[model samples]
Target: MALQVILFMTHRGRTQQLVLRLLQARRLFPEDRTGSRTRHQRIAERLGLGYQVSVMVPALLWVLTPALVDAMSAPAANGTAATRGTPLPVWAPFDLQRSPNYELVYAVQAVTNVVMNLTGLFLDVFFVTLMLHLTAELDVLNLNVASLRPSPVAPADSLESRDGDSLAKQASTDAPYTARGDSFRVRTSTSRFHMYRLLVKNIQHHQMIIM
Candidate 1:
C-alpha cells in the first residue's frame, strides 16, 4: 500500500499531462465517427461493470466467511468466552472482540475494505477509459484513411472536355471534404495534397498519443 501510494505520488504529474493531452486530442478529433455512444463507450461500460463485480464479489466473500464460520462454531451458553476473529486483523484502541464492538468493527472494516477496493477499481477504470478513447480515435483515423480513393483516370483528349465533369464528380464523391482535396490528378499542381494532409494529421495524432 505504501509503495502504491509512493508510485501514485511520483506519477501524478505525468498522469495529469496525459489526461490533458487526451482532452486536446478529443477536441482535435471531436466528430463521433460511429455516431452517438460508439463502440468504445459500450466497451468501457462493460469493462467497468466487470471490474466492479470482480472487486466486490471477493470482498463480500472475504468479509462473510469468517463471520459465518464463527457463527456456526459458537460456544455453548454454559461454556466459557469463545475466541472471535475480526474480518481483518487489526489492533483497536478498545476491545473489538466483545459484542457490538466486534460487530461494529467488522462492519467498519467491511465498509473500509469495499471503499479501498473501489478506489483501486476507479484508478483502473480511468486508465482503461483513456485507452478506449485512444482506440476510438485510431479507429476513426482508419475510417478516414479507408474512405480515401485514388483519383479516377481522365483520358488526355477528353480531359479538356471533361474538366467540369471531373470537378463535379470530385465534389459529389468527397462531400464534406476539406481544403486539402487534391487527388492524384496528373494536371493538378496540388496532386496528392489530400493524402499528404492525411499523413501529417495521422503523424500529429501519433505524437499526441506518445506525449
Candidate 2:
C-alpha cells in the first residue's frame, strides 16, 4: 500500500520538464505543427499490447468494475456475514462495516481503488509523452545554444596544422616546392643553412623575396 501510494502520484517530474523545455524552445521555434485543418478518416490498424494501452486506462476500469466489486464483496475465511444495519469486518482497507450495507461499502471501495489505478495510469502515460517531446526540445535547445557559441581555436588550429606539415616535409628531406593559391611558397636549396627561400605574395606591392 505504501509503495502504491508513492507510485500513484499524478503529478510527475517529466511533465514539468516537458513543459519547461517546450517553453524554452518556443522562444526560438515559435511555430507549432498541429494536425491538418481538413477532416480526415481514421486509419484502422491492428494494435497489440503496449500499443496506446494508456488511452484505454479509464475504459478498462469501467469494464472491470463488476469483477472488482465481486472480488471485494467476498467473505473472509471466517465466513461470517454481517447482521442487518451493522458494519462487517470486511477484508477491505477501509470500514465496510455496515449491518446490511457491508457489501455496498465493499463494492464502493473496490471501484474507488480501480478508478485511482486508472488515474495513475493516465498520469504515467501523459508524463511519458511529455518526456519524449522534452527530449526533442532539448536537442533543439542545444542547437540554438551552439549557434551562438564562438569558434575557439580556428586560426590557431590552421597555423598548427601548417606547422606540422612543414616539419613533416623537412623530416622527409623532400621539399618538392609547389605553388599554392596566393600564399607563400618555399624555394629549396641544400646549400643554404635554412635550405629554403620564401617567395611571398601574388600582388606586386605586397611581394617579398625572403632569404
Candidate 3:
C-alpha cells in the first residue's frame, strides 16, 4: 500500500500525460456512424459501477464483521459480558471502554475504512475508464481506415481543381471522410488528401496507444 501511494505520487506526471494523449486522440479522430461511441461509453460506465459494487461490498462486510460478530455472540454464563473490541485495533492515549469515546472511535474507524476503500476504487475506476476510452478511439480509427475508398479521378470543375481552398477545408475538419454507400467516397483529389491525412492521424494515434 505504501509502495502504491509512493508510485502514484511519483508518477503523477506520467498519468497526466497519458490522459492528455488519450483526450487529444479522441478529440482529433472521427467517430463511427453506427453509434459505437455511445455504446462504448455505456459499457465503461457499467464496468466502473461493477467494480465499485464488487470491491465496496466485500470491504464493507469485512469492516463490519467484527461488530456483527459481537452483536451475535452470547454473553458469558457468570453474569459477565464479552469485551467489545474496535473494528480495527489501534493504540489510543485515552480509554476506549467508556460510552461516547468507544462509539466515536468506532464510527471514525469505520468511516475512515470506507473512505480509503473509495480512494482505491477511484484509482481503479480511473485506469479502467481510460482504457475503455482508448479502446473506443482505436475502434473509431479502425472504422475510418476500413471505410477508405479507392482514389477515383476528380471532375475538372470539382474541388480538387481549385487551388488552396480544398486543402484548407480538409485541414479544418476532423473527420475528413464523409459517408457514402459502403465506404467513404471521394469526389475530388481534395477528399483523397483528407483520407490520407486521416490515415496518418490514425497511425499516430495507434503509436501513442502502444507507447
Candidate 4:
C-alpha cells in the first residue's frame, strides 16, 4: 500500500508538471503554429494525453486492488506450520499464527475494497467535471478570439449614410462626453449581454465620428 501510494503521488506530480509546462508553452507562444496546427491544438493534445493518464491510472489500480488484497491474505505453502524464531518487522503482519484473527483480516480487506471503489468513483467524477470545465472554457476562448478578429468590411464602410447620420446624432446627445487627451477611460458595471450591446453601439458611434 505504501509503495502504491508513492507511485500514485509520483505519477500525479509528474502529470501536474507536464500540464504546467504545456500551459506555459502555450502562453509564451500563443500564435506559434506548425504546418497545419496551432499552439492551442498542440497544447490541447498534450492536455488530452495527460487527462487519459490521470483517468487510466486510477482505473488500473481499481481493477487490481482486490486481487492484490486477496494475494496478501492468502495462506503460504506448508500451511498451518508455526515458526518460532526472531520476529522480522516485514513478516510480522503476515504471520498468521502470531496474529490469528482471520475475521479482522477479512474485515480489513473488505474495508480496503470499499475505500478503493469509492476513491475510483470520486476520481472518475472529478476528471469528468474537469474535462467538461476545460472544454467549456476552450469554447468560450475560441468564441472571444473569433469575435475580436477583424472582418473583411471595415466598420466605417459597413454603415449606410442614414445609419451614420442617426449614429452621429445619437452620439452627440447620448454618448458620454470627454475632452481630447492622450488617453481616456470609460467605466460600466453591467451584465454580459448588455455590455456587448453597449460596445456595439459605441463602436458604431465611433465609426460615424471617424467617417
**Whose lDDT is greatest here?**
3
Any runs in candidate 2 off by more than 4 Å, and if so which? Answer: 1-18, 30-103, 138-211
Please say which candidate is ahead in TM-score: 1 or 3: 3
- Which consecutive 10 residues in model 4 have the weakest lDDT in total? 83-92
Kindly report which residue pairs in candidate 3 clash with one another. Answer: none
Give all candidate RMSDs, comma-separated: 7.4, 18.1, 8.6, 13.4
Worst-scoring 10-residue span by lDDT in model 1: 154-163
TM-score of each: 0.67, 0.33, 0.73, 0.31
* Candidate 1 regions with alpha-carbon error over 4 angstroms: 30-32, 35-37, 68-82, 90-94, 151-191
Cα lDDT for residue 119, candidate 3: 82
Q: In model 2, how large is the Cα lDDT of residue 199? A: 14
Q: Model 3: runs farther than 4 Å from truth?
A: 90-95, 157-194, 207-211
Residue 204 C-alpha lDDT in model 1:
83
Residue lDDT tens for model 2, 1-211: 4465566455456445546645554454532232111111111111212434754554566545654665567575788863322212346465545433566774566566666656655555555554445444444434333334222322221221233443333433435444444265443333331322111111111111110
Ranking by TM-score: 3, 1, 2, 4
Across residues 1-211, which tens digit of lDDT does each residue of candidate 3 receive?
Answer: 5566678889999989988887777676647676667778899899999999998999899778878888999998997877778878887898777778888998999998888888888888887887788788778767877888756544434453222234334444434434333355434455566677777877887887777
Better of 1 and 2 by TM-score: 1
> Residue 84 of candidate 2: its Cα lDDT?
25
Question: What order do you get sorting by lDDT, best first?
Answer: 3, 1, 4, 2
